[model samples]
Target: MIGVGKIKQYSNVLDKPLSKGKQEVSLSAFAFLFSELVQYNQTQVDNIAELERRLEDAGYAVGARVLELLCHRDKGNRRETRLLGILSFVHSTVWKVLFGKVADSLEKGTEHEDEYMISEKELLVNRFISIPKDMGTFNCGAFVAGIVRGVLDGAGFPAVVTAHFVPVEGQHRPRTTILIKFAEEVLRREARLG
Candidate 1:
């Protein structure tokens, strides 16, 4: 678990005047830093997938710690366990805690009993991501996916989260949909209990 003092310090940094009421930070800054991060990880890894995975893992660690702190501060306790309940918590409370807004949409997969989707446009970190042709496999969406996974796992969801880019017809910015598929045991246990 992350310490309370650290979380508060980080939040305060984000709330600085430069953040401007937390409206949004500079895309250029995020992009440049993220690009450098990716490049640095690339040197440490053998392939593109590994580099992306490293980024995702890093995001997941942050998410886990953030979730813990948020729950501690707001709920004065821990988080929920029910699938739909925790998903809602992640979509609204967790989203706001991290990105300052609720997700655009949250839906369960009609076709898959164990799957749910959390969709959002204007993903904070990916606002300026422009993947080059050579780096076709690169997608900053994985970071968000890792976040979802971390939060859910912290709340005992035990799910696999994947981030996808799905652009709406009129939306200029890319929309990211995080697909979460719960482990079979979770669904079975929920069904048995309910």
Candidate 2:
């Protein structure tokens, strides 16, 4: 069973009933707060890479906690070991827990057995992110990539996660895909264990 205490804490913080399985929130509020956070972190860091790494660290903490909550929510199911299985768990379980919906798609990298992807529409951070011409290298999705990395790491995957914006042909909004690449040792161990 899910941790009743944690769920109750979330409800109390959000100031709403806890029995409901889900709730709606204002995206504007989230966007503004996230922007401010990014800006604040920017001031504390030396360069773009460092700034991104800091944001990812923040997301990593959230990811670790989220993984615990989700596992409890699912009645403590054994953690996934296979590459495909864990990737699916991240796309559906982790995505839903964080964003209130499953990712739009989950795919494997054709060229790499260790690489996986989770794509989503309407990424929360990028919804209002506008990069100025002077700062053409900014991407707010690094936080999300960090979260994915944290989740996978907490689950023993030890992978690198990168977030990219891929525009769908007909979709007005860009699709954000989080590419996860497992370390070589992890893949080798899996093979040996199997």
Candidate 3:
């Protein structure tokens, strides 16, 4: 026989409110775990591009769940349907949830109407990473790109997202910029809606 307190009551556990989607892990712990993820993926891939894609795929899964949670808990289950709406949500809300801060910048591409970029000085994923000399231009932020893509795609704004490293004047390490090129259908839909 168990004591009164020792007996777990399902009602008590069920009565508690759900998290507001503000959960976080320490940066050090995240770095360690992310490193392990990279190391494990390294063994399975033949090249850096493949590894990055795999990581992006993993991030995509996380992003989908994140959208589901945030929609239910924080946003009152409202989904962003407009292009700018979803972009803002990903740039601000998603980044804040995942990285503890909003993205440094979200800008439209000067050369393309359908392209946008989310730039971060030192993205959380790339902060602790030290790329090998052989792995030229391999930004760990591909995982983050995946997250952005996942969120956008899940929210009915399908787009092609890629991560790039852009040199900043006087900065030793380049910043990670996520480039999002919306699908033609998405662009058409946007124009019609506007």
Candidate 4:
């Protein structure tokens, strides 16, 4: 069919084997594409929440694919099984691959038993974005949160992920913290297994 041939032509690049050498892209090109994605999603939604949800949904798809490919590339085709193991993978490997560096800090929630946090001084997605004052408490890092949520859910750990901006006085850049809250059943299961 004509459609089938066209689809194959468009997707042929994806069929290529992964090479050992690093695959690099222009950061400016990515920033342009990402900005356009945000602008398009912004025009479709009435509220900040809806716009962020759309962005997150888009990131979720990318994260799902990245999880599979990165697991194969870095873990020798093995998948992480434990909560800590997956957290470490995300904090180190995923951050490195996505941002060209690891996150600033990974911390357990002090009050909550099922909550974890990953803090980045300058989130990659937010580096070029400037939220208008009218947008209220909007943070573009929600897209990254969605990516983390997708990766966890795909790895059999269903959780909610939220991104918050925490500004530090005397600091040049604000911090973005991604909070991950696992379901009660997941925590219970971990306890039972241990």
Give the winner by lDDT: 3
lDDT of 3 by residue, 113-140 (tens): 9999999999988887888888999988
Supply candidate 1's per-residue lDDT for 151: 85
Please list the C-alpha lDDT of all candidates, in the order they appear: 0.79, 0.80, 0.89, 0.88
Off by over 4 Å in 3: 1-16
lDDT (Cα, tens digit) per residue for candidate 4, span 62-176: 7798799898888877889899999999999998888889999999999999999999998888888888989988888888998998899888888989899888899966799
- Tens-place lDDT digits, model 1, residues 1-194: 34876744545565543321354666677778877877788799987788778888977997898788777667757677687888888899888867778999999899999999988876877776677779764677788788888888887778888877787898775677888999998999899879
Alpha carbon lDDT of residue 15, candidate 2? 57
Shift in Å, residue 145, candidate 4? 0.6
> Model 2, range 1-194, lDDT digits (tens) per residue?
35866654443554553233545667788888898989999899988788878888888998888777777667354677777777788888788767788888888889989888888786778878876666555567889988889878988989988877787898875688888899998999899988
Clashes of 1: 0
Candidate 2 wrongly placed segments (more than 4 Å): 1-24, 170-173
Residue pairs in steric clash, candidate 1? none
Task: Score residue 167 of candidate 3 by CA lDDT.
Answer: 95
TM-score of each: 0.79, 0.81, 0.90, 0.88
Using TM-score as the measure, name the better of candidate 1 and candidate 3.
3
Candidates ranked by lDDT, best first? Answer: 3, 4, 2, 1
Query: Which lDDT value does model 4 have at 186?
Result: 84
The numbered model that scores best in TM-score is 3
CA RMSD of all predictions:
7.4, 5.9, 4.5, 7.0
Distance from true location, Cα of 42 in model 1, Å: 2.4
Candidate 4 at residue 130, lDDT? 89
